[model samples]
Target: MLPPGKIPPEKLREIVFNRLGAPGERVIIKSDLGVDATAIDFGSSVLVASTDPITGTEERIGFYAVHINANDVATFGAKPKWFLVSILLPENADEALLAKIMDELHESAKKLGVAIVGGHTEVTPGLHRPIVVGTMLGEVSEEKLVTSNGAKPGDAIILTKWAGLEGTSIIANEREEELVKVFGREFVERAKSFISMISVVEDALTANEAGVDAMHDPTEGGITNGLHEMADSAKLGLKVYAEKIPIREETLKICEFYGLNPLALISSGALIIAAPKENADDIISALEGKGINASVIGEFLEDKDSKVIVENGRERPLERPESDELWKIV
Candidate 1:
């Protein structure tokens, strides 16, 4: 049986990616391991589309569904303009539950200036909880289109925000009573507010404007998995400093309580950017100017098999996490 999180990359290549029937001629980007969104050639502009489902937490599922998919499109240097959702409820769900979800979806979409174009909603059988699947669409000019495969060997890798951001919020919300008993209501509430930082649309756009060869939002499997995906997609090796990667205090305490590796948790608010060494400083500066914390945590290397992380002056091979640390707790 497969793990509870995303399918392993090897299995994905064997069972899923290799099984896609006929390839579309207009598809500029096809299904791949690291690439989250697909681009279709449409004359002067390319249409970028991405889909993601929220099943980790019941709280703010609608908000998560919208921003998570939107983040994928924005990582390709596109502005998400239209959204579609499929809401599946459990058999015993009530109208109040659906109403709350719809309200969240509407507020989130409006905040992002995206239109809810169309979708389907139904009560699914045998489901224990509600699941919201969202698809986001955006357009970008051919010249401005950026893909995850564009990172070069010498480019500097930049990381925005802190690691394990989404997982921290999910844990705080899902385990509120337990956490509050140990850490008090103030700390738990602060951790829960991490949900507000779940979107990386601004981070991607600012970095793209400052000049980035590649950009990716760290979703499931946190920043470590995200860095691995970036290197794999670019066909390059990377050396990142463990000390340079930021982790908030709330996340640290919460992870310690659960014996989880923050770097291996789900991270949505953070972004991974690869840019030429010469432009890295400017990119960081632009992101910081917009009040988004960013740092050059590493650099891609010419050796494709040299992925490593430097900590305390020692180098260790960076292992790809089998599953997100969030699953162990929530």
Candidate 2:
């Protein structure tokens, strides 16, 4: 049987992506492991679309559904304008639960200046909690379009925000009773607030304007998996500095308590940018100027096989994470 998290890349290629029946002529980008969103040629502009399901935690599922999907469209240097959602509730759910979710969705969409176009909602059997699957749509001029495969060798890799941002918040909310006993209610609340940082729309747009060859929203498999995906998509190698990767104190504490690797945890708030070495500093500055923390954690290498992370002056191969570390706990 397959694992509970995402299907392995090799299996995805062989079973899912490769099985897409016929390719459309106007399809600018097809489904792939590292690609964030799909682009289709539409007259003078490119239409970008991405969909994601929120299943890890129900704490802020509605809010998460909007931002997470929007982040993907933003990664392609597109402005998300319309949203569609499919809400599946458990048989035990009530009207209040649906109302709470819809309220959150409305507020989140309003904050992002996106309109809720249409969607479907149903009470699904055998489900224990609610699941919101969101699809975000946007358009971008051809010149402004960006994709994960655009990263070039020798380009600098810039990271926005910190790692395990989403996982930290999820753990705090899902296991609040257990964590509060160990670290007080205040700390848990602070950790839970990490959800507010889950949107990377600003980070991507800012980096794109500052000049970036590629951008990716680190989602299910965290920073490490995201890096691997980018490299794979671009067919390039990379050398990352372990010390350069940022991690918040809350994420560190929560991961340590569960003996989880923060680097392999789900990281939605962070963005991965590939930019020319000359533009890396400008990109970082632009992001920081917008109050978003960013750093040059690595650079692409010429040899496609040379993927490694330097730690304490020692180099070790950077292996792709089989699954998100958050799964081990939550």
Candidate 3:
């Protein structure tokens, strides 16, 4: 069986996506690997939709449920407006736990200016913890719609914020006691606060306005797999500079302690933008001006087979992560 992360891109294309039914003209963007959201034409505007499930950690699960799905829609240069979630409660769950989850959902959605229209909630047997699956709907103008496949050769690949943001928070929250012993309470608490950085809506919209060709939020497979997804979707290659990739101090310490690669951990707060080399700096500045850290990690190459990571003069093929490094500890 596949491990607990995103399905491999190849199998997803062959077994799952290949079976998608044909859509009429209303479908602007159909299901595709690496693509974040699908779009349907609605005359004046395009309705963008994305769905994601939150099952990794129980702490802040409600907040994660909304942000993860909304982040995908935002990557399409859309503003998330409506949300629907499926809440599955574990057996023997109490009313207080359910109330807490509902309150979190409401607070999270309200913060993002999204409405929780409707959803189904049920108590299931043989479950250990609660799971929230969210579907987000957003809207974008026709000209502003961006897809993952829009990246072109010679485009500079820019990463906003730092990698492993989500994984660090999850680890700190889920294994606080274990981490506190090794890294002290202060460090663990700082790492746990990274959950506040999970939303990339502003980063995505800023890059879109700055003439970015493609935008993606690295989720399950982290930055390494995120780059692979962009390259795969665009049918291009990437030459990433390992030293150029942004890694936060807290993230580095946490991953080192856990013996996990920070680059291959789930990172929802980071935004990947591919743009023309000439416009890359402006895009970076735009994001940084908003208190978001941005860096040029690499460039898209002409050769489709060339996915290289240059680090300290050494070269290596940037392989797609089979599963998120978070799974190792979680």
Considering every candidate listed, which one attains the maximal lDDT?
1
Tell me the spans in candidate 1 whose CA falls farther than 4 Å from its real position.
Answer: none
Every candidate's lDDT: 0.94, 0.94, 0.92
Q: What C-alpha lDDT, on a 0 to 100 scale, does residue 261 get in candidate 1?
A: 94
List candidate 3 stretches off by more than 4 Å: none
Residue-wise C-alpha lDDT for candidate 1, range 22-69, written one tens digit per residue: 989999988888999999999989999999999899999999999999
Question: Which order, best to worst by TM-score?
Answer: 1, 2, 3
- lDDT against true structure, model 1: 0.94
Query: lDDT score, residue 220, model 1?
Result: 88
Error of 2 at 241 (Å): 0.7
For model 3, give the 10-residue run with minimal summed lDDT: 16-25
Q: How far in Å is the alpha carbon of 271 misplaced in model 1?
A: 0.3
What is the per-residue lDDT of model 2 for residues 1-330, given as tens digits with 9 covering 90 to 100?
Answer: 888788899998889987888888999998987987899999899999999899888887999999999999999999999999999999999999999999999999999999999999999999999999999999999999999788999999999999999999999988999999999999999999989999999999999999999999888889999999999988999999999999999889988999998999999999999999999889989999999999999999989899999999999999988899988887
Task: Flag the better candidate by lDDT, 1 or 3.
Answer: 1
lDDT of 3 by residue, 1-330 (tens): 877788888789789987877656799887777987899999999999999999888887899999999999999999999999999999989998889989999999999999999899999998899999999999999999999789999999999989999999999998999889998999998999989999999999988998989999999889998999999889999999989998989899888887899999999999999999999989988988999999999999999999999989999998888899989987
The C-alpha stretches of model 2 lying farther than 4 A from their native spots are: none
Which prediction has more favorable lDDT, 1 or 2? 1
- Backbone clash tally (model 3): 0
